[model samples]
Target: MRPREHASQIPPTRSASIETVLVVTMDHLPGYEIREVLGQVVSSQARTRNVYREGVKSLRGGAYDPAAPENLTRWRTDAVARLGEEARRLGANAVLGMRFEHREVGEMWMEVCAYGTAVVAYRSPAAPAPDQPLVAAETAHPAEPIDSGAIAEAPSAPNLRTAGETPTRPD
Candidate 1:
């Protein structure tokens, strides 16, 4: 199979081309979750009066403080963008099994990782063609290795849902 190419070569199709696989380290951060943890720490330090205030300030000032949710959000966003760019370069229209890894370095440095498999995807083919087309059929088959030019002709699948149809729930 040929290596992936940047999105420029293949014009973006109307079909999603995007795949379903995605992964995240932290699923959701409800306000209550953050509040509860902070509340407990605050209450515990209340016994020492102003000590908690200093602790909070110090935490905020720390180079790798967890209090900075915005930094984490930005990191995540950039990582995803990088991953997407990599996928695009590989001629993959979608990424699957996406995941992130976080590592703390010493007292100040932290590293965040985002990774996934890049894939060239098209909507599922309808009825099979009687004879193989000019491009190799294996190129369109997910299990088979990819073929650059062969992928260009793969037909996109039709959307099953109508305008009024409700989306089906996952089992």
Candidate 2:
């Protein structure tokens, strides 16, 4: 009998376009994010922490213990993957100001929330301004704050298109 060829034997083409941006926000997950996306599956499981030498040392009166390193790593990886999946769903290429929040639910239960703003970012045409040295004012007198009315407001995009024309679209 002739040997059967499998689809996995074929390599992906180099011409394939790849998404350059990735945005992620996660809470907690059991399985890997990539696995979930590819396999279209997701699972959640509660994890427990084990006390260790470091955790014990850091605690006062030997009241605290360390958590399992393996479980911690796995949970973190899954959370990150879930966040990335969320960003991908939102059509965001990158995430900014990512932050995590931890909360204790019960005696042994802890919750972790990973969050950030996801956006599609592209390189700007102009270069950023150079850094400048700070200059202290010699006078101790306070300067008057600028009035809001004195500043010019940016023209709205909708108004720009109209340019003095009567409103064609209903409110």
Candidate 3:
């Protein structure tokens, strides 16, 4: 078969759009500092099976797979996208502590929910150089210089019997 023409020209769907709002499971973003907590943002989507069709499929040995990976992924993506939209509306640049919950209503309906705390965040200032300590040298108390002679004259460990030698009991 000939190669498909203009395959790249098609615009991506809304669900597949570039994520503008950052969503992270961590309580805080590594390189970003949170400025304001907008509040909790939540999005839920529910899907129902066609009872008649599913019944027939099951009878014919082609049972519907509700827990299919693709279905679950799509559900999660859609829920998260909705959550991001809500966060954007709240003037948040990122969502922290994101969580996903799935619930089934009997055998017919499935619901996927995404929730997180929305916050305004900005990229944190660049970190100090590896060689530089977190605390300033001027404010910190200077470490005293070590005396090699003192260390050499320091008390040694207590005398003990060597291997295979029996220890004497104290009276």
Cα-based lDDT at residue 150, candidate 3: 46
Q: Point out where model 2 deviates above 4 Å.
A: 1-20, 23-46, 49-74, 126-171
Q: Give one digit per residue, the lDDT tens place, for model 1 in 33-142.
A: 11111000000000112345447767878445453676677676666666655555454545555676777655545677777655544343354545745454455565
lDDT (Cα, 0-100) at 30 in candidate 2: 17
Report lDDT (CA) for all predictions. Answer: 0.45, 0.42, 0.70
- For each candidate, give its TM-score against the true structure: 0.39, 0.39, 0.60
Off by over 4 Å in 1: 1-56, 59-67, 126-171
Q: Candidate 2 lDDT (Cα, whole model)?
A: 0.42
Q: Would you give me the overall lDDT of model 1?
A: 0.45
Query: Clashes in each model (backbone N, CA, C under 3 Å)?
Result: 3, 5, 0
Best by TM-score: 3
lDDT of 3 by residue, 1-171 (tens): 111221122222355331457777899777666777989999998888668867778897996665577878888998888987887777776779999999997899998999999877766678755587644332342364445454222234333456346466779
Please provide, for model 2 over 1-171, each residue's C-alpha lDDT reduced to its tens digit, 9 standing for 90 to 100: 110121122222221221333433342221212212211212233444444553666666765344455656667555555554555455544445556556656655656555666544443434323464222221222264434555333333245656778656778
Give per-model CA RMSD.
19.4, 18.4, 12.4
Please report the TM-score between candidate 3 and the true structure. Answer: 0.60
Instruction: Output the better candidate (1/2) by lDDT.
Output: 1
In model 1, residue pairs whose N, Cα or C atoms come closer than 3 Å (at least 3 residues apart or on different chains), thus clashing, are 4-90, 5-90, 5-91
